[model samples]
Target chain A: MDSHSHPAPTADVATVAARWSKKAVVVAGVGAVLAVVGGLSAAKDGGFGKQFGFSYLQAFMFFLSLCLGGLFLTVVHHLFDAAWSVPVRRLNEHLACLAPVMFVLFIPILILAKQIYPWMQIADPASDAALHAKSPLFTPGGWYGVSILLFVLWTFVSFQLRRNSLNQDKDGAAIHTQNMRVHAAYGIFIFALGLTFAAILWMKGLEHQWFSTMYGVYYFAGSVWTTLATLYVISLALKKAGPLALVMQRNQFHDIAKLFYAFTVFYAYIHFSQYFIIWNGGMPEETFYYVQREQGSWWGIGMLIVFGHFLIPFLAFARIDAKLNIAVAIPVCVWAWMMHYCDMSFNVMPILRPKGFELTITDLGCWLFIGGVVAIAWLRSLASHPVYPLKDPRLGEALGIHFHDEGDAGHAPAKASK
Target chain B: MADSNIDYTVKLGLLAEYATPAELMQAAEKFREAGYRRWDVYSPFPIHGMDDAMGLGNSKVGWFTFCCGASGYTLGMIMIWWMNAHDYAIGVGGKPLFSPIFSFPVAYECTILLGAFGSLGGMFILNKLPRHYNPLFKVERFSRATHDGFFLFVETSDPKYSDIETRKLLESTGTRQIEEVRD
Candidate 1:
């Protein structure tokens, strides 16, 4: 077996990150100020407050996708005992760690819940059929209770996974691996249920009357799809930037791209099914959601999603070689971010600016502010630790090393015999 | 006993035996660099990186799958449209006679079905499969290819093949045995 050398110290990555952190702080400040200005102006008639509420909710959901995507990736890595992703696992852990930050971020939405969610304002639940049927969950107490519980469950699972992982970096013990498996065993359930519930409460709740059993998975598929693109760009940067050069291999990028390709189809599959089922069922209650989205520019945005989100990436990365080409991959990654923002806007903006898709200062501010905060938090977490798990048992496997066992001692070592 | 019925007249190729997969891989790289086109390596089990060692690139089987799958979807949509709207004009539930929405489930399944057929057919075609004869079948030692043996065979038809030169190249890779196969 070939032994890979230990990764060098992360001083170089840390230096670059320090510069980025400063820039991120500036961006975050600018975004916050802009969002505040937009909010105050709109508050004259509560137009901007409602706008601010919906815009922030959209941006919040977008970032939440990344955090949940991170947790999902980390949980599965342990569950499958995957080797190829071992190099990128620490990045995933730090991303998942942002769940607590997301909980803090959720405070704004909690305050604006009434402004954002109309169902909360209805005097009597009995007056509204859809609202009444959904009863306890539709109630403000149930909404806030379940919302807090989701964050708690997510933060717990994300921290447990990361704690075991970081401890493994210290001791390289099999026990850490075992402990993670125990967490992941239950973590998968938490992830599925928690993500579904959050999507229902926060985004889907905007239209409390809407009904789609596939809504949770629809959000999940898109979230992970965007997350994979983000991971690809980050891992590639780290590889070129020197922290992950030794451990990262060609196959890692290829595999990541391949998974991204699969999710492109998967996201399309899920969203299409959601639409197809409702369209076929032809129920006015459910069909109203699509009917509203089909009006005006929301129609164009929907078309953009079908082509830009699914078709373009699906075709662009279809070739095996294209997945490894940084030229092709970087552009697709950027496009994926744009597409996901559009998707989030399509879901959230339809309620506030039902005429069409409008890009407001609040929208941009909320996006930039939340994105910068997450980036700063993620960079701080990344710089503080070893860029990759230093002592992972499967690190060698990820580096493409093949070890022959003691049973093969009788065979002549190839190079020596040659 | 069955093999005794045939006569060996034509020379088929040159074969070299390696003790292990690592040696086979090394020899494969040498042959690849030597620019021999009609050669292959055989081992008891699949070897990773062997394709690159032998200078092979991505397979072309994907084209077959894509084209066939696309056609299957197109054909499926057309089949539904012709049967329901163009031919009979039956009204069911007052839905559009041929919206891609209603036809999609069937079309998607057709894409998968024909895509699988394309994969199987492409593999068989590219491999030139259902082949009934090979001179290597008569080489007793080559039978170990299914067990512990690792072998390399360079066909005489290769543009680069030369009895002396090929033998010297195989020898340089540290193969212990080399034999000339005959048909």
Candidate 2:
């Protein structure tokens, strides 16, 4: 029988679902406790609480970027008809589900908007003249509602498409493909709008007077970078679980790694462009952002990302042979995750401590809390479906077991299995 | 050699068909082990490691990318230098004439553009693409190659080829339904 015509392997859906559900409940419980404890601790210690508020806002922004990145990946994969991503595409889709969870997480930002954002307090006539001068350009209520609405719309659309895809797999419906394509096209438009408002709300609004057109693209580049990294780590974990093992292979891993590498370069380009432009322009307002970031304790973190995010990883994964090696790939993935956290800190912390101080426990706690919440939400989504789309038309082709090689001695090619 | 060519054209001998992917791959490996070099396998999709099985070398696209990327970088530097430093000399932002930082974005774009073009051109030159026709398409059964068939062609032009000997080698390697081409 030809590869495409072969029946899918039978698997116990109930068993997979139960395992993931249990894991999700455990993670959610832990995240809830941590968030409560972290929140209470911040309130008790006024100095530390202020830092906690900022870190909590940063974590929300980071997770927001991660989910948005997944959304972009899903769109790009469908646009290009990429077959290699089929194995990991489900994981990315599930991660995209975190957008709603992040929307809820953003509640803390709204509560602390006055403390975290200078724009929110501009109504006080006694506030600093410089802050009042920037108030005309900044509107907190408008930004908050817009940001939340955009997230809701993006989540609703993404979930719809993801649902259709899963349903298509079970019933072998071809129309769903067409439905998804149409949805994705519209989804891309919403994504662009949502992403712009998100950048304005989360990052730009931090310093309300500060403005940069490149900020939107900068945020996007970072989002995609972290998303690709998250997808790689999750795919590796899934392969280790042994259910989707047959679908995952070295070639697939290599492709994802290449994408990660490409986006790191893209991120660096956007970052340098923003920095050089502002420095050359010499606008005091514009230069203030960089001056704060380029000096003090944060400068080292910035330099580390410049190298760790792009240079080090670029050199390490330049060769095809290295991209194919899991041992090498794993470190690059881990480093990417670290670089993302550093990048987020660079974007947020400057507003809080313009002079740049040492790392604090609040920063670490907030990241852990956000990480736990995101992990739990993502695991819950995975519990609802097969890890790999078993009935996907491209799965066989992705597995490299198509019709042409039938009856050949190379049927189970060594490389194919890898 | 001329006599063998005539024999091959007249009829294919010891023809048998494979019904499974595993069998076809096994036959391919057998051919590899037997040190056969003048054969080609046609598949509906790209199979991993099939190149090694067929003894193909690494692709030359990388060399193309490197050369084109270097040229692109050089061109970007020269273009910006001529436009800003030499031609107009209009300084708006008090920036230096030869700003590597300013030139970086343009240089990066050029690198990607040239690299992409180089890969495309190299692929075209290497694969001899855009040809309207090929002699291989003349074979009736070969059409299935783009669909469901995996085929190995032991060309008559190869130095080691003889009608009788090649047929024996193919049969021994478990290649089913071997065919001959007339050029």
Candidate 3:
């Protein structure tokens, strides 16, 4: 596989990264201006501080999905010893590395925690039975401590994975592969615990009175679904840009698209199961969450999640060829971003804007700001490393080239062109 | 060995054997370009990309699965609505007599059950698969298809098939074995 020489890609990585970095700064600045203006405009309605708090939290959770999703992908790659994902593993690593950036961006949420979480603001927690029952985990100290711990765990896992991968590129060492497997073995447990806690504390904690055990996996299903869409587009762009053209084949795109398709059904299954159980039991505590969502335009947003998020993607990509068609894939990926945004809003925005679903300028500003930061960080990570693992053993398998070492006469020496 | 009867001398096709799956795939591609419709490649195991090499299109079984699955869902919903809401009205938990939400689990199950039935039945119908016999079965070497052989067969019925030309094509593909099958 390494014997074939590739023509350099038309696009330069450093120049592209530099250009995008400058644009990201501008985007963040512009986002700040828009957020301030939106906040001031809504001063009389719910106070500027409150509006900023809700908008920031919504944007925070939305972007966090990509990070958590990236972490899941990276961990699973090692766990399954997957060959098809070897080419895209580097991209996912950079995505997971954004955990530190997310940790820094989380400052605003920490600052506005009291404003964002009603449980924190309640004067007498002992008065409310729900708050009193869950007093240990929902307390301010517990919340902040757990939040910081989740970030620390994510950064350590992702950075270690990337470090071993980069080292392998320098010297084609099998030990790095074994090391990554170890990290993934322990990292998966951390991921499940950390993700569940983050969802429970950050989003589900908004409704302190409501009860639902399925909330964590529900958020998880949507996160990975959105992440797969983002990965599809990224892999496509990088392949066209030249760096990944050699390693990426139709096999990569087809497999990624198929995984995305599976997640679509998985997300629908999880969301519907949660709804069905709640709707069937008709418990006051569980029903209250859906009841609040049924009000005003929230009802329409819920319907959108059902149809737009589930049905459209399901039916559109039902054909076998649709997964491989670029025209069909790009549109579906873009639509996934929109649906995931609506999903995030459906989860976080209902408490703040109880009347209905509305897209505020503050929301857009926050989304742009966080997205810009993440893009710059990801691009820097991309520029600093070889676009793909240069010497990973599976690289040969991924490219459809089989290697026969010395003394391995048990296998045929035939060359099969794929 | 005195069974050389002229009455049974009907040419069914030509069978050509290649040493490996790679060569077989290359030959399949050539046969596709030659526009030979009634032909196929046989191997002990499936070769990836062989479908493309053979110029085969997507199977039509999906239509059967989709249509049957849709009917299964619709019928399930209607059956529940008729039985519970109309024929025998029984109130359970003061819920509506019929709701898609409550009935969804059953309907979804029906969809899977019928969808599976459709696929199995569709495959049988499309492949004409309760096959009793074929002229190829008479070729002793052809039985190796279930073992280690990689063979390509082009029927005499195919428009592009000429015994002389097809034999030459197989020779060009680097195969040493060729034989005719009688129906």
Candidate 4:
């Protein structure tokens, strides 16, 4: 091994804040305006409450995944004590921080629960056997309680993990790393369970009569799939802007790109498995979901998802080098994000417009609202501290891995230390 | 012995063994820096930076896997569609012959199957592997390539190579042992 060591660089907080604050203000401002416009427009549509319910849900699922999936990645990062991920881990933490924001967003859904779930307004629960059977869990009170508990659990766990990561930036203590490991091991268990239930609560409950055990996994697939897309987009943007240029290596981006490829395959697996199982069984209740999807523009979008989300990406990222190849990765990531939007749209929109595809102004507005607002919030959190985890012991190992290409190896030579 | 009357196994090259990864890496660097092309490095376990030291890019097998996977998926889809939709038209579960939905499992499975095939195919092609014997096998110390030995072997065919000079270079680079490997 050759001797080469340098102190990890930290971003100037004031500088980051100054650069991002103006953009943040504009994004959040536009988001708030569009959301309000979307909400107001929904009031004029026939069954205004119902229209808003699904439109809001579409936007809700899209952004909630940014948080949920980011949290999942963050906890697992800690659980593994992954040295390679340390440079990019803080950004993942920022995304995970959106869990609290999602909770705030979830409140509106709760207030509109009756409109969102027609069953919440059921007149004679005694007459409906299936309704009666699920009454204990589906009661307005029980459902709301579960929602609260789930978000609370998510917020607490994610907050702690991020807090630990940030704290290590100050002390570089072994204790923070050791503690996060324990938290993450359990955090993953909670994430899997809570996300499954959250999937059921948020999207699956739309048609109360229909259910699939695989429904939760389907959402899990899209959640993480979309999350990876979002991660790729944000990290690449940051790198290009030079905020993360110094701290992040080609390997970090490459590793996350590899993850994006993996989830592409995994998303297809779950997607295919769920559809095949439901189609194979041909049960009325189960088949109804696919039946609705097989019609109108929904069918076309579903096929787009199959090819766009799965096949195209699977082929695009076939090589480990694809990870480092920003040209290939950026386009593929953009496509993947588009596919994820379609995935979320396909999941929620088909429910509201069973007969055909319907595009409402509110849907567009809500999307802008969520996209801009969430991006603003994430950027704020990003600027609050050093972009990289400067104090973590693995920071050295992470920055130490070198690339063969000398073209962009502007940093000091990262001798392979292992 | 006269060159034509030499023992049947032609001289392969010099095989040098390093006691540690550092020594092997330094030697690899020296060899590459000195513009030696017909050469290779091997260790019982993978060593980081070895690829850079040898001036190698990523393996080409990834493209093989992609092509194989794509072909597998396309072929699998056609097979399922032909069997269910066109040739046989079996309507199981009232699913259309080419539901695309139902055929995905088959297509997905094929993608994985052929992708694996591609990986194996790529491995064999890139490594020029599966041949059982090497002249290096005749060197007892070279047996450690699969266990503890870290080796740098420059073929006699290399333009810069000479038995005496190569051995001297190996010795100076901290290799514990060097031996002539014969075919």
lDDT of 3 by residue, A1-418 (tens): 3523443332465565677689888888888788888878987876777898888888889889999999999999999999989989998998999999999999999998898899998998899999989878888888999999999999999999999998998787899999999999999988888999999999999998887888889999999999999999988888776677677777788788888899999999999999999999989889999999999999999999999999999888888789878899999999999999999999999999999999999998888888888888888888877777877888877765432443221112122223
- Indicate which candidate wins on DockQ: 1
Q: Superposing all C-alpha atoms, what RMSD in Å does each candidate have to the true structure?
A: 3.7, 6.1, 3.2, 4.2
C-alpha positional error of residue A220 in candidate 2 after TM-score superposition, expressed in Å: 1.9
After superposing candidate 3, which stretches have Cα over 4 Å from the reference?
A: A3-11, A402-418, B1-4
Superposed model 2: Cα runs more than 4 Å off: A1-49, A79-82, A124-137, A404-415, B1-28, B35-49, B52-60, B63-92, B109-167, B173-183
Clash count for each candidate, listed in order shown: 0, 23, 0, 0
Write one digit per residue (lDDT tens) for candidate 1, span A69-121: 99999999999999989989999988898999998988989988888899999
After superposition, the stretches of candidate 4 with alpha carbons farther than 4 Å from their true spots are A1-14, A400-418, B1-11, B74-107, B159-182
Give lDDT tens digits, candidate 4, residues A96-169: 88888888878778888888886787888777665787777777777999999998999888889988888887
Weakest ten-residue segment in model 1 chain A by summed lDDT: A409-418
The lDDT ranking, best first, is: 1, 3, 4, 2
Selected candidate, larger TM-score, 1 vs 2: 1
The models' CA-based lDDT, in order, is 0.88, 0.73, 0.86, 0.78
**Clash pairs, model 1 backbone:** none
Chain A accuracy as TM-score for every candidate: 0.95, 0.88, 0.94, 0.90
Model 4 TM-score relative to the real fold: 0.88
Can you give the DockQ of every candidate in the order shown? 0.38, 0.25, 0.34, 0.33
Candidate 2 chain A lDDT trough over 10 residues, lowest sum: A1-10
Candidate 1 residues lying further than 4 Å off, grouped into runs, are A1-4, A405-418, B1-8
lDDT, candidate 2, residue A403? Answer: 47
Which numbered prediction scores highest in lDDT against the true structure?
Answer: 1
